[model samples]
Target: MLRALCALLGLTSAAIAAKFELSPKKFLTLPLGDIKPAGWLHDQLQVQTDGLAGHMHEFYDLVSKSDWIGGDSYYSYLEEAGSYWFNAMVPNGVLMNNSIINEKTQEFLEYVLENQDATGWLGPEVDTEKPRCLWGRYPFFFGAIQMVEYKPELTARVVDALHKFVKLANRMLRNGEGVDKWAATRWEDFVLTLQWLHDFHPRGEEELLVDTMVRLKWSGVPWEEVFSEEYFPTGPVENLTNPFGLELSWHGVNMAEGFKALPATYRFTHNQSDIDAANLSWDLMFKYHGRPSGAYAADEMLAGLEAVRGTELCLVVEAMFSGSYLYQVIGDLKYADRVERMTYNALPATLTANMWGRQYLQQQNQVAAQNMSPNPFPEDGPYSNVFGLEPNYPCCTVNFPQGWPKFITNAFLVTSDKKGLVQLYLGPFEVQTTLNEDNLVKVSVETFYPFGDNLNITITATKSYMHYIRVPSWIVGGSMTVNDGEKTGLVPDEVTGLLSVTIGKGLTKIALHYPAKIVIEERPHGSIAVHRGPLNYAFDIPRSEKIIAQDPREPHAVDLQMGPIGAWEYALDADPATMSFHNEAENDDHYKLPSPIFDSGKPSVSIAVSACSIEWPLAGDMFVTSPPENPECLGDVKTIQLVPFGATKLRISEFPVFAHSEPSLRVGNSYQIGDDSEPVQKPFNPTKPN
Candidate 1:
């Protein structure tokens, strides 16, 4: 039976022209908690689960008891918001390859699945106000796949539910029950879920079901033409006068998810055009609407390249998901690099250090995280930047948790042949998975990562295995040492250009060292943003947070508003060689932190530089805009501190460089520091990808 189904789903010889093999023979995500976080990552997840994300259902009616997915009566029936809340909050206490013991998650899963009707409806009963929605089921479908690793016992049930729903959906489309308006723009995600089902559960009528879903999806949107450059303009369609653009691809969240449709379809058709379409879509987005923090401007639509424009948290998570799948199908490390930048920069900056509150929108060059009118976000409300249980929308409060858990899952993956482990991103993590069912590989990676350049990986396994490591494009002369031996340069692949190696099992030690150099990036309107390795440096604006209690009876209604307590406008020397990299926490033991492991106020690494105060000021803008082009030098250059972008809630990431300043070079000992004694090197002039 399985053989017949697999053959039925296989592509024909004519469709294999440009096909590439995925690293893992199977596309399986680890069960929750399988890839356990270590060092600071572990602390961050604990803070997330212990705070609102873990217990929100108890307080928020959207997840606790709404009509959708058996919740209470805040919404009439299973609405779009509830479905998203379930998808984001489902992975909270799940341990990878293990069972979900939390009574809340367990009960939620049991109630929803057991209530599945014969008609393939898993949500609440259909009513006049809330009829059956294909859009509502789509989120649940994707969420079920994400949770399947931790809840293996529910695999068959999930597949069965999906089969029933797709069958019913096919009938609805044939009988003239058209796709819901809300679901039309998200056809890509629907197709993506169908493709995932076909990949994982290809032992039944998988091919027929997926084809039906794809056809049903395509019947609505002209996705093929929309993704092409001819149909979609490669520039910002959003401006101050008109913020809410109606074009399907112009909407930020839609475009983020939509980029994956062609890539996912390419896995079956093996068509080069599919790959080209995906590339074109991404190129256009970054070329016009890109942000300094690795996100695109979408105050609900395609805002421009300015740093003050806000991006939705939903778009941020969706873009990460799209990038992960794009990497899996295309086998490229660039996708991995994009995910890392967003995870470290945009994802963390929106939430509080304790994870109790979050903002609906975050700006790349934000100087204050406060609620204000006349904000730049054209579509969002005045309270978009307030950190709370739910600011402008409840969607972010539920969607934000998906980032860290999914990042942990994708950190380490098995190769296509199951003979190697691919370390996609750099961070402190420990993973235990089988290489080939008989060969168990256990690895512990320790590093300060974006904070520092040194990485120590220890591997213990039953048999010899191959390993694949990613070397970012920014690294020029990357090298690794085996068991405290000499460093050797790597030979990367011709196509992907990623570093690959073979190793023996049983307690092997490997160390990676690459010098961090300053790379100056030109922003819109001739501003500058500095980068060191994967970390983007930003002015650490001192902030004063004010917590407001909206309702004394509802403690969860409290919101946090922050404002800058110091000046945010500064222009640094134009020469990248003059900036000094300093580690203030170099001597302190990481394990001996007083309480909360990460101290955002005092970042571990910082940039010390001399800068002159500028006349750059805030306007009717969201926060503070970019610094002036050639500001009046207020006084002599004064030394100021710049910290990692993710560590600061309020920051000035994009600044104006002082072009006519005297060169004052200083250096340090990391990455390939420059010719000077201080650890500095000449800038690597990188061109933005087309």
Candidate 2:
């Protein structure tokens, strides 16, 4: 079955064999500036620029005067605050081409690179006897690599400095120097940098790079063993006292970063068990702790499936990055599906619509965004869910910027054979890259995806090539029409879920329609969640936000305490088959998606369903606890609209189902919702020879 799937994905025997011997990446990611955001996506980036992404450095002292840039004080013991800012802002600056941000990024990069110690070690750590934590360098190098990609002149300097660091890292790992703390548990970031250097700019240092990877793997946490069924935690962790011991494995951000370690190491080991364990890691995570918003419960530690449990913003972005990496390495459609799900739903749900202030943690069924006594999170503080600057910690403030920029750059990938282009995730973006070695191709995708069902793609190529469009597993009966000709049904490869189309040179226009339908997902405690396309839907509770605190340096950026101004205790009282979509876009031909599309009252699509007010009680006067197993309607059923999950600041995503009189509606040839179908966890066999 694995061999047959590989063959279906166009993997030749040679390519399959290469998997066991430092194989080529399944997809080659385009550089940072190659893919530019367009349409609403462009607006989204611009808003980020005008918000924290663009101004944080100017006002935030942790970033402006961090030790990495030679400041006297630092934000954390790991010295990663500045590096986190750099990792996020560099991509944002380069993608938006913002002069101010780009200039600032260069200034920071110059200081860090020029001040590298004679020992090849970066940062401000000088105590030689003490064990150095190499975790900070991982994010620092991630940003530095992008800078080199955008500016080729710095390639030599950056490459030389990285080589020196890797040599130092290799020696340190051999001894007992680094990897003593968080670095040991989350060493995938370090290995990822090594792999990048090996694949792109080995410069005769390939052996050293491989050795460094091996040493890192050996010294790092044995994630394969941890993710095994015998050891993997099947429920929320209760022990919070020993956070640095075994409990660190359950840390949300650590789990998000560590899950990808085995998959990444597989590129070198080519061990089939590593691949299986990697797939199982994902399956077990979602099964036990998954949230309806595509995030797993991890406030600071692994919280359970209770709706009130918080998922940190840092975890959300890290999971998206890991998911995208898994897709690129394993070439599985399921990983891509997850990436889309998080990008469309969870990423935006945690932030303020303007992107100025963000929550340290978000709840799946949050009724208010405020501080709580006896907080819901096992390890986070009371203010974790409030919208503020550095509410619980500053990590998210710097780390969240990488989410969208990386997503855009990874949206389109060149196939491993370099003969075709694969549209991995759908969005409004323009990509300019070479396929088949030097065949320059530029493709523009314009769509209100997750809102509108159609993608209008225009391709202009110097040479004809095969274009593989990923048909999202959520999409049913998708079809395509080329050059305004008759529409043809698209039959995607069963395993890969990709529809291949041949594209000729010059201008080619294509219209792909993925008819969106509602899906009812059953959740714990007799609750249910609604979905359409890649988006998760929620009851948008109207809220009144109060400015509780303001940053004097940037007064417009203020912390918010928001509570529901309207009714939020509601239960679904209608059949899924009878629900209808209320799309604002359909009513107007010239509908423009509102700027800051994630804001309330701006949703382009919504679902109107029969619901009744219920007497769901709060856990701690702030947290919306689990709904009643059989919620009784308080009064007559009324129609309420559910907007996209990302658009609501206060929402009920998982709702209790109120038994209705009508039977389940089944339309002709329509997909049914509320089915008991689990996601297929098919492990790819890396040892399979072509």
Q: Compare the candidates by TM-score and give the number of the best one.
A: 2
Give TM-scores for every candidate, taking all chains together and pairing residue i with residue i: 0.88, 0.92
Clashing pairs in 2: 13-690
Q: Candidate 2: list runs displaced more than 4 Å.
A: 1-21, 66-78, 126-131, 240-245, 660-690
Taking the tens digit of each residue's C-alpha lDDT, what string does model 2 give over 1-690?
Answer: 324433443334444333324756687787778899999999988988898878988878778744444433345423678888888889899889899999998988887777788988887554433446688778889899999989999999999899999989888876767775688778899888988888888887776776677667666677877777777776678753432356677788998999789788787666666678888888778877887688889888888788888899999999888988887887777778777888889999999988999999998899998888767677788898889888998889988988888888788887888889999888898988877758999999988887788899999999999998988877656679999689998778766667898999899999998875676666788787777877888999989999999988898678999999999999995367656777888657798899899999887999988898889888885787788888889999888999999988899999898974443533331224433242311211111100
- Which regions in candidate 1 have their CA more than 4 angstroms from the true location? 1-28, 66-78, 95-101, 176-178, 239-246, 494-497, 551-557, 585-599, 660-673, 676-690
List all candidate RMSDs to the true structure.
Answer: 5.0, 5.9
lDDT of 1 by residue, 1-690 (tens): 222322454544455322222222233355565688887677777777777777666667666654444433334224555566556656656632213325655665666677778887776564345446576666666667766766688888788777777778777766656366556667667777766666677556654654564455454555566666565655556443322233555678887877777776676556667787777677667767776677778887777777887888888988988887777767665667777778877888777777778888888788777778676677778788888888887777767777887787777776666677888778889988877758888889988777667779998889888887877655546679988678897666644545776677678898987656666667765577777777777887888888864535357557988888888788876666667887644555553222233346545777776688878877764357656776777777887877778777888888886664433432221123345544222232223431
Show the lowest summed lDDT stretch of 10 residues, model 1: 16-25
